[model samples]
Target chain A: MRFSVLILGNSSATPMYERHPTSQVVNHNEQLYLIDCGEGTQMQLTRYGIKSNRINHIFISHLHGDHYLGLVGLISSMHLMGRKTDLHLYGPAPLEEILALNFKYSETELRYNLIFHPTNPTETAVLFESKLLRVESFPLRHRIACTGFRFQEGERPAKLDIDKVAKLQIPPALINGIKWGLDFTDKDGKVHPSSELTTPAPLPRSYAYCSDTVRIPDYLPSIHRANLLYHESTFLHEMKDRAVETFHTTSFEAGEIAKEAEVGHLLLGHYSARYKTKELTLLLDEARSAFPHTDLSVEGKWYEVE
Target chain B: MRFSVLILGNSSATPMYERHPTSQVVNHNEQLYLIDCGEGTQMQLTRYGIKSNRINHIFISHLHGDHYLGLVGLISSMHLMGRKTDLHLYGPAPLEEILALNFKYSETELRYNLIFHPTNPTETAVLFESKLLRVESFPLRHRIACTGFRFQEGERPAKLDIDKVAKLQIPPALINGIKWGLDFTDKDGKVHPSSELTTPAPLPRSYAYCSDTVRIPDYLPSIHRANLLYHESTFLHEMKDRAVETFHTTSFEAGEIAKEAEVGHLLLGHYSARYKTKELTLLLDEARSAFPHTDLSVEGKWYEVE
Candidate 1:
């Protein structure tokens, strides 16, 4: 299983020459999950060559334009391309109303089933669960009602020790059972312990996405120790006061949250348009001072979590 | 006056790799008018180096997502930029409902006044008028209530014949009156006819935008003899059946309409994504067979009306 995040856009409020707004795609196994689609997200997806048809679920943090503007276009395109699979959309209630009105006036009847799941951003709840992963949303502090999502991979099966299996002349079925953490029982009533024949599975990996929000310490418990954390850093340290006033976070503040939460790696993004490409280094340095694993999020870049 | 149509997006239904949905910026003098705002219009504006602050009015053809998905994002960006100028939005009534719900959920108080002018696409009405131009909407045949707009320049002043003015030793004030189509009178009551002093102004230019509509002969009366006509050509001649089935027009049909309307120049655009850039020549050729003055609408190309 591969758990990773592809940054589609990383600017805030308005798209600039240097950066875009908020959009990310989380790839887990064979499925793709979209988070907070901003303007030009479909273009970003095209630029990265990510198959948008593989995306079955979309999680929108809020009704803010920068966070969800690309959604209707993406949905409309899917229908035009003859997509028949059901699309699950999770967001605030108002988003559905907006989408419905447009569809109503356009006389557009979608070919696919659109499922809407409205959530309260102040509550912590499991949004959906699949065979390979589970998704949950928690509260975040913002000017509007916004939520953050946590994606956790399912537990993995044990790995069989090939050398031991060959030395013991074990059958393939017995090795499979051992890998499933089951002891092998022979016809002669002899039993082989699973632990002795197989190695333990690796720890399950998780990723948390915090977008368009101020630094909220209360979300630490839900997102703590995530393998990877993507947080909005809309401004540099010098704009800390502006960040607070606008209900956003600085890169340094994002790094502090990641360090306090004990996340494995931190990806800082949602940069303000005022900073050019050259000034990104200043933000990276400021963040690295608090979290060494912090890295600036660039569009089209993918981060892998092991 | 500069009468240029900046192609913000030309893709239809769903956004594709090289094409965007319907959105164009019509630049006339110092004012910028948005014709149809599709998703990612703001990014397109930024990419094309258009100043978003210059836009004072937005005219939506219908309630299709591809036509107006970018409205909320653009409005939000204006608020974020602290824009104090009032914006006039003309679209179907449902658009106001959608925007209202979005503003409520996001808890956004726009710093500028967003005047919503609900349009009855089924009727022909004068929508807006300014010192430089007048805009009126005419009925268009589509699946929904859609309308096309005609932007006509205000009446031009008569041009002064410099040699005649110099020979007659006419005062500047008298020249101004002559240009205004009034006869000049001297202190001794000697009158000079305006026609003898000045020549007629060049015909006032006009541009008609027929976006996302099927073949409609009824609109010819309203847009006849326009200086330039921009019509949506979503498909080619071979896809005539498909165009009719989807309430869209092919390049051939667009050219036919332009020929019947006796438009000075026909501009064909809104290409389907399935066709490559190389295939655009085929579209242009089809249109030229019927209307020799037809031209393909290319992005970043500017058209000036003299």
Candidate 2:
């Protein structure tokens, strides 16, 4: 199974220099899911050669302009381009009214069915589910109602050992049981342990996204053991006071969260516009000091979840 | 006095390679006025090296997202940059509500005074006026309620004839009257003709912007004899039927309007996304076939009204 996250924008509220606001595309086995579409996101997607048509689902974390200002423009462009597939949108309840207002004023009749799945930021619960993956939302500490999403890969069935199954002369009726790790019996009344007939299943991978939030203890468990974790690092240690006042996290605090959660790798982003591009390395280094496996989330960069 | 127009975005609806949606800046005597802010207009202003702080007035033509979607993001950035100047916004009544909704959801209280001036699409009247310039709004045929703007220069002062005034011994109190073309009384108790005391005033220049509209005769008088005219040319001659259906103008129709209004020059823009940059020249040539002084409106180009 292929799972990767492509960073479209990583800057904070204001897009500075070549950096853009918060936006990303999560490619889960070729099914694209968009996370936090900021302004200029459609252009960024075009710059990165990502087709907007592949984005079947969109998840918004909050009502902040930096996170969701680009939604209406992207949706309008999609309708103009003659999109017909039903799009599933998950965000706060106000998002539906916001989108409806735009359409009402523009007199745009959408060519596709837009399905809105309103997400609650006050509680932790599963938001969406499929055969391979399940998405859950948890509360985040911010000035406004906000949410962090966690993608958990579903448990996989054991891989059948084809050669062992043939040699043991397994009946067709027991093939499903063998793949499910159940012991099988042959016509001669011979017992075959599931370990002899099948190989162990691979470890399922998971990813979590937390942004525009302060360091809070409640979010630690939801993002624990994620194969990859993306957390907002809006400031460094020097600006820790400013970060706290803005309901954002410092690089050190982000690293501490990553460490406490024991994630496979940490991706730090949502940098403040006050810092220059060259200064971003300081954030990455500070995060790495606490959690060694940390990297800066750069626009157009892709990180795979192992 | 200085008057110039800077093209920011010229695409009709969809933003394509190297072309953006409808947006332009009118610089009048060092003061910047924004017109029709579409998505990515802020970036376009940055690309053209225009400071956002200098824009104190913004005019949106209609409720179409391609016309005003970039407004909120630009406003937010200005606020973040510590802008305290009052912004005078002139557009349809719905525009104020759209901006208010964005700020409400984002929980952003402005740092500057935002004044809204509502425009009626059914009537032609002056929107704003100063001693040297006046801006008026007129109706345009569109799928929805739309307005076209006309920038009319006020009467110019006559050039002073210092030698004639000295030789005639004209009173200092009559200098203002002399520039305003009033006959002056000489110190010798003789009356000197106004023509001998001062040179005739130069012709006042004017410009008109008609976009997202079909060819209509009602808008002719408001734009008559404009020094420069920018009209929407969303399609080529072959797509006349489609243009009529979509409430857009083809290059030939745009040229015809310019020719009928006796404008000094014609600017054609709002190109369809179907045409590449290489093919834009064909639209210019077709418009020139009807009106010889037609030019294509490319982004970042400045056209002076002389």
Candidate 3:
């Protein structure tokens, strides 16, 4: 299975000439999940050739314009394209009301079903579950009620050791049982352990997205051991005071969080427009000093995780 | 007075690779007014060097995502920039509710007062008045309750022919009276007719913005005599069936309306993404067949009214 993330936008608060606001697309297998669609997200999707109609689920972190302004436009475009598949939207309580009012005034009846699942941003709980992945939301310390998400792949069955099974003359039915972590018995009633015939599968991969938050150490437990982690770094270490005042995190602070969480890799984005493109390298260097796997999130770039 | 219109975005529903959605900035003297901000409008404003703080009023024609999606982001950016001026917003009733919900959830204490003026899309009435301009909304036939705005500049005082006034030995006070279209009377009580001394001031310049609407003949009376008119031409004449079904107008239809209204200049925009830049000239030609003064609206291009 292919698990990756495509960065669509990364600028914070205000959009500048070279950077855009917050938006990212998470690709798992053949499905795409959109997260925090800011203004011009649809344009980014078009530029990247991502079929927006294939995106069945969207997760909005909060009501901030930079986090969700593009949602209405994205939804409207889907309707205009004659989409008929039901779409699931998860966000704060008031988001649905806002969308409903807009549709009411425009007299727009979407051909697709827009199922809204309002989440409580103050608590940690499971937000979505499917056969391939399970998503959970954890609280974040911000000016508003904000939450971060953790996506982990479902458990996989054990793999059969073909050489060992063949040498042992394991039947096809017994091979299936061994893959399920069950022991096989011989005709003479001799017990054969499943571990002897099969090998354990690799650990399920996971990713965590944390944005628009200050230092929230409490979330480490839920986000720890992620294969890939994306966090907002709105400022550099020199502007830590401003970052705290604005409920954002500095690059150094984001690196510290990734190090403490022991995530495999850290991708920092949501840069303040004040910094030029060259300054991003300096910020990434500061982050990498603490978390060696740190990298800057660039728009239109994709990061793949096994 | 300098009267000009800056095209910020001209694409239809979905913003394409080379075209952006609907947005325009009208500059009258030193004041600026924003009309129909689509997604990514803030970035467009930055690209064109439009100071966001200078826009004190915003008018939205409808609740379509392409028409008003940038409003919340613009408002948020204003707050981020520490603006203290009040902003007047005129739009459909549901917009107020959406803005309120966003503000409520974001926990944003706006630095400026957002004065929302709810507009009834079904009625044609004066929506706002300022020292320099009077704005009125006229009904338009669309898929929803949409309206177009007519911006009429307040009448200017007549300019005195300085050479003529000086040659006639008119007093300063008498010159002011003549500028106000009053007859000048000499000390001997001899009456002077106003027409003999001064010509009528140029008719008040006006601009009308009709976006995402069908060619409704009834609107000609409300928009007649406008110095400049911007109308949506979402398709070509061959797509008339699609235009009517979607409540949009073609280039030919847009020109027909402008010709019927006798507008000075017709600006055609809101192009369908199906056409490329090379096709724009052909579309303009089609429009000019009916209205000789028709022009295509291009992004970052400004049109000045004499």
Candidate 4:
């Protein structure tokens, strides 16, 4: 039941002050999903000890260089490393053309199956679904077509009570079924309810990633009440006009969005190259002015989804 | 009069053991020329305190992802940073199509001009020439179309013998012409030979870059008697057969090439991922066995072309 987000790169537009461009990884029950892979992402993945080959799904928010520049290199590395598992990539439709042209020029036929899924940047839609997780993409207002993602965990099965199971002499094969809410029958033909053998599962957690977007109210409901929300705070309140002009979010605006959506906790990232290390606190302070429970996204750290 | 190379990355195929893919910077008289911009090259430039905007010319060796994947990102950064001067890029013909497609997808009309010059990988030809330097491209034996570059310094003007000129009371305006081997006719009607007022110019220096290639004699004459040579050594002698199959050069083979060309010094790079830090000494040892004036190309270190 491990759910966490790892920040690989957190800077905006360009890499400055030891911070790389925008990229991160989300882990749900050991399955890794990469989000917004910027330049130096592969090196960052190696630096953070994340095995990139384990990543099966990648979601690109936009086609901006800072958001998706490292994609081709990552794909090539995966191919050279002899990956055979099919990789599912979700991004803007033109990204498929970019990848095809790159591979065509390089004369490379990827050893693994690359399945591309075109994400409609104009609407909200469910991008992926599994037994344990569901990922949805929602539109974001930007200079180019962009989208944000919300990863919500589905209802988890009840945990098996090992002590109760041992005392009841439950067979090993039936234990897995019992964890899935199956009723067990005793050897003497006495029926046991599933509720008696298991503990209630925890509430499903959700994490949302919003980047390279202006402050807009249209998609507030899509990320409402998420366990953890990562919002782009490209500038401070002092640069609010610049934020509006560039279709980016100010620190205060990001905080306001988190507060309006009523998220559990707010994670701010995608900082402009203008801010130095000590000045980063000003951004956090400004965001906290609007939303009290807010923290800055630090690269190479794993933030639990809670 | 500085002629040196800074290795940004020195790995082959994939980045491993903290080594990124192949990329380097050649600095001649303060002018920067980028070669083989692999992934993370811009970041590497930043880390090494090299202002990438100063690079006016870029030479890509091949279409391999490790060789040229960072070109688009670097170009985009230059555009965003408000570059106005033209950028000269030399590579295969298809590279133009790649750049056009990338820009079309990003919806970016670059602020600066990107002047493209296609290199012929089959024949030797002078690609660029300035008053001080001449760059020539030659064929390389690789799986794909690849070219090696030779940066040769043009004939330098003679240096003024300042003490002799001062003793003779030469006028300031005439001093410049004396350095270029012009004779001075003194007001006293005395003739001063240009040789008497200036010291002989040193020999012109040249550096050759050969990478991603198998051992072949076709390009040996093009690099003969170079001041310095940077050659790819993707594998050790133990993997000689593997190197041959992959159209790559082993460490011993690279050393042999340097020996046959009679280069001033040999720089061995593009190491395979199989070698660890301690094992890298073995590569150096193997190259040194054939050519004694050989050293491994260390990233971030500047190697002067003497």
Best by TM-score: 4
Q: Can you tell me which runs of candidate 3 are displaced by over 4 Å?
A: A156-200, B157-203
Ranking according to lDDT, highest score first: 4, 2, 3, 1
Supply DockQ values for each candidate: 0.73, 0.56, 0.64, 0.71
Q: What lDDT score is found at residue A160 in candidate 3?
A: 82
DockQ of candidate 3 against the true complex = 0.64
DockQ of candidate 4 relative to the true structure:
0.71
Which residue pairs show backbone clashes in model 3? none
Tens-place lDDT digits, model 1, residues B157-254 = 78898998887778886766688799877667888889988888767899899988999788888889998899988899899899999889999999
Compose the digit string of candidate 4's lDDT tens values, residues B14-131. 8974798999999999999999999889888988999889999999999998999889989988888899999999999999998898888778899999999999989998999998
For residues A1-306, write the lDDT of model 2, one tens digit per residue: 689999999999877757888899998888899999998888888888988989988999999888998889899889999999999999988889888988998999999999999998889988889988898989999988899999888887789999888888888897887777899877889888888888898888999999989988998999999999999999998998898899999999999999999999999999998889998999999999999999999899999998
For candidate 4, give the lDDT of residue B153.
Answer: 97
Q: Look at candidate 2 and tell me the lDDT of residue A61.
A: 96
Q: TM-score of chain A, model 3?
A: 0.90
Candidate achieving higher DockQ, 1 or 2: 1
**TM-score per candidate, in order?**
0.94, 0.91, 0.87, 0.98
Interface RMSD of each: 1.5, 1.2, 1.2, 1.3
lDDT values, one for every candidate:
0.86, 0.90, 0.88, 0.93
> Candidate 3 or 4, higher TM-score?
4
- What TM value does model 4 have? 0.98
Model 2 regions more than 4 Å off: A157-199, B159-199
Cα lDDT tens digits for candidate 2, B1-306: 789999999988888857888999999889899999998788788788999999998888999888988899899999999999999989989888888888888899999999999998999988899988899999999998899998888998898899987877677898888898898775667888788878889999998999989888999998999999999999998999999999999999888889999999999999999999999998998899899999999899999987
